[model samples]
Target chain A: MKKNIILASTSTVFGQPYLSYLKEELEILFADAKEIIFIPYARPGGISHDDYTAKAAAFFKEIRVAVKGLHNFDDPISALQNCQGIFTGGGNTFLLVKQLHELNILPTLRSVVDNGVPYLGTSAGSNLGGMTMQTTNDMPIVYPPSFETAGWVPFNLNPHYLDPIPGTTHMGETRETRIAEFHTQNSIPVVGLREGSWVRVTDHKIKLGGPLTARIFEQGKQPYELSPGASIEFA
Target chain B: MKKNIILASTSTVFGQPYLSYLKEELEILFADAKEIIFIPYARPGGISHDDYTAKAAAFFKEIRVAVKGLHNFDDPISALQNCQGIFTGGGNTFLLVKQLHELNILPTLRSVVDNGVPYLGTSAGSNLGGMTMQTTNDMPIVYPPSFETAGWVPFNLNPHYLDPIPGTTHMGETRETRIAEFHTQNSIPVVGLREGSWVRVTDHKIKLGGPLTARIFEQGKQPYELSPGASIEFA
Candidate 1:
């Protein structure tokens, strides 16, 4: 069987309830699953793993899908192997990647998802599904053993991809500049997923979803936009 | 000799020539030195190290101080040790830190700067003088062996610190939120250095320099601002 996944730019949008923006997408994504196990490792602080997981549960409750935090399980690998569906909420990619590496479960997470377990990821969680976390916008609060991440998707992802505001005088490097810098050292393609945008994968097919056009950055090429439903094909 | 350093928030403010914003400050910092060695590792792309160094050389020329790129040196460590003064121009912090680690010159750098070789740093360069580069705003395009830095000053730095725009729906973490997350994992202090602001150090004395007030974040405490010339005292 082929892998199934939905990697979203963000779990929430401006002035909206948590996960409310993706309500329809979640319902369809989790249609056949009996239960969804959440990995709340992205949000390490500001909220406890159980508390963060509860937030996901509340949302899943709306869709009538039973959900539990992966943190509650003694053996997370085993739990993931037996789960019907999985959701990884967003937070700091560094923290999430570190935890995944420390637990020695990156391989397990990849294998199960490859075994056809449906998966959903938002923001930092979505970054983990990409080639590397090096393009993350998060501060390096902690160091991970490596910049490598799950290669569920062929390209690295810049979640919540923002455009440079026209009138802003801020001297900080814009999202495009940072990713351009990333391209200098890496050959992998990058998708600049705007808010409300997502990458939907069915088996070997990958397509862009949402109202906006996602920006694409590849090594040695100018960034261009891909319209909704456009295929994000890779070799 | 006491450490003599000027760590500016940026090389240039918007609408200003490179390093021109800190002209007066640099004059005082490098007054006694006949020449300044420039570190151009922060800017890894878009410009060559030779070209980046030329920019710095041009700025130093305006002040009538001879400047040379560290890249031209056969031994970066020895050149830094014997240099009358040093200047590290800003670009990407991750690249700067990674190069510093790979070249095995971080310790040599810290020792020389401590031995009282007058030093000037802007943005990524300024971040190198901090406790750690974990607080840097630059994207992690490269992974260094370690996040540790020079510790020329007690606190970490967030260069090009920007205040959130009054109205925006963009959900990317604001500069404040990113630093807040940093506090969740580390106890090191962080100074949000806005454009035109800098940290001045002389011997055991540290003070906030430049026009704007800097936002300071300490562990388990609320972030607050320090006015110009205010002592940045630390134990």
Candidate 2:
């Protein structure tokens, strides 16, 4: 089994419907599957598990596929093993990782994802594919046992990445500055996946998707831009 | 033996010298002390400890008070105990908290601040005065042993806080949304300290300082604005 994943920067770009842009790609990726196990642990905007799950289910319903929240299952490990596809929605990364680690099934989740389960992730969900969540932009509302992620992807991710707005007087650090700070103490490469952009991973091939160019940050090196359709297999 | 602290939202505002706006207030706060111990653990922008300390040293030098980096001493705990005043600079909050917890001196540091030793903190440094650093906006470049902070202040602080940029299309969560998400799980109140705004704690009184108003978020309540000079003592 080889990895099959769609790591999206965000579920929706500004003025877009929920997961609307990725609908075609999703239909292709999960073509053979009848249903997906939706992990709503991230709970975007502090939404409840059931509500977040319903949102994903609504999207999949349009594609004629059934959806089930992982929380609905008594055994999450068994759920993953039995599910045709998996979709982790956007939300707070800390909360998601906390639940994952607390369940003590990160290894199981990673193993199944590694074994070629069709997976879809957005925002915080996409961040879970990295080696660690150190590059996340979300607030640490909760403390997790570790910063480690699923490591389904070779490099860490910075989803919903934004370039600094010009002529702004705000003193808050920019996306690039924050990632540079991450590199100061970390050696891993980080992919700055801008809004409307994503990474499509099919076994060994990882291609940048969408209209925007991605930014790649490696320690001690200048960050370079990656155009749409660029291959990040070497990253 | 009551808290006497200055928690600033940022170390420097745009178009101003470092710590310039607060120089007069600082001189008055540290009037009784001949020197202040500087904790450079935050290491803003990934700067080195000594380099960041020197920046603070230069600013304090103008006020005729000596400055010493906590890292310069052979024993950090003893140095802190014997210090006349203490100042912690801003940087990555996770990195700052990680070092403080690893050193196992948060309790000692908190005890002294609660005992009326003059204390100054900016950005990440100020977040340390809260119950936890979970409200911080910085990237979590490193994982700390805990989300706990000194708790010298009753509520958590969100420094360098920014409201949504008017009319822009970026979809990242606003400061208010992030804090609201934090409140979804944690019950602690979070103070959104705008850049250039700060809180001055004198004995039991906590007053909002600087030119701008601050925002306060309590769980299950609408976020309210706090005008300068307003008392957050109830917070």
Candidate 3:
């Protein structure tokens, strides 16, 4: 049997109501699983290991929860190697990538996922499953030496989709405009997920969630929208 | 006499009127200097060394312009050892920080400034001179191992400040709000500079620039605005 993997978008314990929904979904998805290894080290927002572990413990109290041993990257790798499922909580995507790259866990992560470890990601965690970490809103809290992402799920995921600012000529482009600019430079499709919306990948199929629509942009094409329950074939 | 430093906020040769102002300012500042060194290697937006050099050459045709000898961080340090002043162009701040940190030039750059070497930073270059590169709008194009910034300047500079977005429930914080958040966490004051506005720093004095008012925020106090020509004492 393939182990499960869950990647969450945000590390805020109770910020988004959808987190509970996601937790419930994972419980149903991995009902037969015996152990759940929660990895909260991805949060680099100054939260300590104990704090993150406690946060996970609070949420996963109903389940058999075991916070992943984070003495170092090797422990996370070993946990991945033997665990039934892995859950990655989100905080800052860049910070998480920096840690993953520093510890050289990105390659191992890919291997486990390819071996069919059911991976789950929320916000920043969901972002790691994509091709690039360019869409995150977190400040570049740290430099990670490289921008190469996990590339597990194809395309870029823009979490927390927002509209453009009015009447402000800010030097930097807005998130939406930035994504559009990315499409102009590259031919990759981008999925903009609003709050409470998510994408579920099972085997070879990708499904959308919540009432929000996923904005899709492809090169040389007009951007389109996808509603909840819509399944997009993984390309 | 201390060597002069020029920091710019953008590299768009055209389109932005501020570029011309930067050019004029550079001409006036470097007029008396025997030679001017162009540090185009800091343009990390995939701008080729040749192209960067050529752009600097085209801009300062009459003046003796020499591209800094250190193309990447691997070259000899002597390239910038005897320079009159250094001008850094703008691009993606994250990319610039990534390269500088990788080549280990950040500390050396800081040393040059400490030794009284004149420095000029535009856009991403300007962002580098500040205490942290958190305020930049550049997509996290690359991840370096840490978020440590080139603490050349004491405050965070928010170049190209803009107004808030309209009627959006999903409003993420504006640039000002984001900077305020940083101030809440760190005591450092954030200076919001619109295009064409820069802080001229010499020794201990910091002066504001044209038309736009700079928003200065400190912890435990309401944010205030600084009009152009207002001098701030940096301790």
lDDT of 1 at A82: 94
Task: Summarize candidate 3's per-residue lDDT along A163-182 as a digit string, tens digits.
Answer: 56566555555666566555
Model 2, B105-156: lDDT tens per residue? 8988999999999999999999999999999999999889898999988899
The CA lDDT of each predicted structure is: 0.89, 0.91, 0.65
Give the Å error, residue B163, model 2: 0.7
Query: Could you estimate the TM-score for every candidate?
Result: 0.98, 0.98, 0.69
Candidate 3, lDDT over the whole model: 0.65
Q: What is the DockQ of candidate 2?
A: 0.86
Alpha-carbon RMSD to native, per candidate: 1.2, 1.1, 5.9
Calculate DockQ per candidate and list them: 0.72, 0.86, 0.22
Model 1 pairs whose backbones collide: none
Off by over 4 Å in 1: none
